[model samples]
Target: MKRIESSKAGGSQFIPGYVQATDYSDLESFMVAKLKVTGQLDMQIDSDFQNVDGAVSNAVVPELWTGIRDDVRGVYIGEFAFWYSDYISFIAESPNGQFTSDEEREIIEILSSFRTEN
Candidate 1:
């Protein structure tokens, strides 16, 4: 239910509203989410996902990512963790505001297509 209406505020280029959330149960499982809104009603950037890990044994390293793309913008969520450091990345775009959708999509694709160098 955590969703952001736009991609503005917080010095971000997108429109200006967004929702984000994080959840933790015990010390090994956690999740983060984000969403963008349009005109205060529609969900132009419809997107979400979760990342899980085995913190107790520290023997598992897992990550997952998913995305939806369009000319307007792209929405993406990634979850991954290493030991005590948990990482999540959420992104929305407005390369130039006048046309934030296209830019947003491009950003989403790039983030979705990342690979670890190690």
Candidate 2:
């Protein structure tokens, strides 16, 4: 897998070695099945470019937003962040229909553990 790295002016950085999947539809489907949510569910994952001050000049950062069927579920437990030019989204579904506050915290912890530096 190719290594990806990004750094910001304030020393904020992200360097992950894991291979990013081009398509996450299958993963979403699996999670929906595991969670046993009724009806069809759609996963929304996208990124937008934003200008940010870097070490030398203004740099573009990809802001990522990821979530699953927020309309069907009342509380949306998803991730949104701005990381060096790469957008990363770790999707998780709660088996109890909707993610509780505790479950959201746990998911955030799990995703944060994968952070790495080059």
Candidate 3:
């Protein structure tokens, strides 16, 4: 698992989450499993965005996001993607409050570091 922390001055707090890199047979299976694990199986996809490489799919649900060391209990940002048959997912959360601009940038940088060439 990979971890990233918000800066003290960023006005946000985030628990270190489990950055998952899983191998799946196909994207459909990966999506199904991801939705199940993230408690979004019954939720519809609300956003889709293009990343540096693959596309990212997201669903916002009021569910508890469990990480390696902590559980963020609130509305959290759940993002997932499939690259070269590898499934990736992570919960981007702010426990203290809303994320500031700096916090958002830092979070993106941390997530981007997990990207790999197909």
Candidate 4:
């Protein structure tokens, strides 16, 4: 489990999460599973951009996905996944759910910070 936390509030504010990288097949199909997941609501894919992950097997075209999880138990989830060649890197968080606005901003910051360390 991984979390982003801030201690500036006199206490830690955090989002519980999980992340992993592995092999997989299909991008849209992978997302479709999350969308159809029982607790997922308001889910959709943003095709705003496409990029590469040079650290992978050659000719491995990467596809990214951002997802929302819906569970009526007041659980809101934010997820990110990248698929390329036969591998996948994924992240899911907000175990207690998220405020859409707050989640969006934080997600942007996280995405923006993604880079390859030489």
Candidate 5:
């Protein structure tokens, strides 16, 4: 993992980590399957950087995705921000397929398994 900072903000810093996968889409797909969406995700996920939607569409609070511009719809989940596509649409929102206690535990385990190989 690497830490990056903004030179303009008098040294505001952020830690960034990327989880690379050969089947990268698999993780996104897992997230979608694990998510419990009560309604539509309000954006598209499968595309690249050009076409994306913001958190407001999903009713997510701004604080949740820091550094996200109003014009930016893609949201960062941990070190990764997801798009509004089928593979990337996942949220912790209640009643929107709230993760069960066991599921939450599983997710924690999954995230915990991550390590910076470099």
Candidate 6:
């Protein structure tokens, strides 16, 4: 798979991110199935840009299970996903276990501040 777009950020190490194009008939169901199959924890959240046009209404934070991480090693990975309608969303993850809480929030806020056209 290839990313539609991506960006790398600052800090002790890079807090990289990307915009991925995805399609799904039902996002909730798809996420639920993914979480179930993997038996991992995830959550739904509101975006800071929800009031803006084209902002996401339903957002999902699919914990640190979407990428390659050593759960047994207790890697500190952070991930976020915002779903607009059922097919569009922003997904982020730090599989290197290098993201701090502040960085995670920073990522989320940046994600929510952007208004998508579709």
List candidate 4 stretches off by more than 4 Å: 1-61, 64-90
Clashes of 6: 0
Higher TM-score: candidate 2 or 6?
2
- Cα lDDT for residue 94, candidate 2: 44
For each candidate in turn, the TM-score is 0.26, 0.28, 0.28, 0.27, 0.26, 0.27
lDDT of 6 by residue, 1-104 (tens): 11111112211111223336444323222221011111232224422212111111112332322332212122112222334433334444455523466766
Model 3 backbone overlap count = 0
Where model 5 places Cα greater than 4 Å from the true spot, the runs are 1-72, 75-96
On residues 1-118, what C-alpha lDDT tens digit does candidate 4 reach at each position? 1111111111111112222443233332221111112222232553222222111101111223223212223322322223243234433344444325555455444533433332
> For each candidate, what is the lDDT?
0.28, 0.29, 0.30, 0.27, 0.29, 0.30
Tell me how candidate 2 scores on lDDT. Answer: 0.29
Q: Which ten residues in a row have the lowest lDDT in candidate 3?
A: 29-38
Question: Which window of 10 residues has the lowest lDDT sum in candidate 6?
Answer: 29-38
Which tens-of-lDDT digit does each residue in 1-118 have in candidate 2? 0111222211112233334534332222111111222233224432322222211111222222122222332322222223323544433544433555665455545543443443
Residue 116 accuracy (lDDT) in model 3: 30
List model 3 lDDT by residue over 8-28, tens digit each. Answer: 221112222233554432322
lDDT (10s digit) by residue, model 1, range 4-111 = 222211221112112233323123322121223222213555454222221110011222211211222223333222222344344333433333455444554444
Q: Provide the RMSD of all predictions against the true structure, rounded to 1 decimal.
A: 16.4, 16.4, 15.4, 16.2, 13.9, 16.7
Which segments of candidate 6 are over 4 A away from where they belong? Answer: 1-86
How much lDDT does candidate 6 score? 0.30
User: Relative to the unseen true structure, what is the C-alpha lDDT of residue 36 in candidate 4, on a scale of 0 to 100?
Assistant: 19
Error of 6 at 72 (Å): 19
Off by over 4 Å in 2: 1-62, 66-89
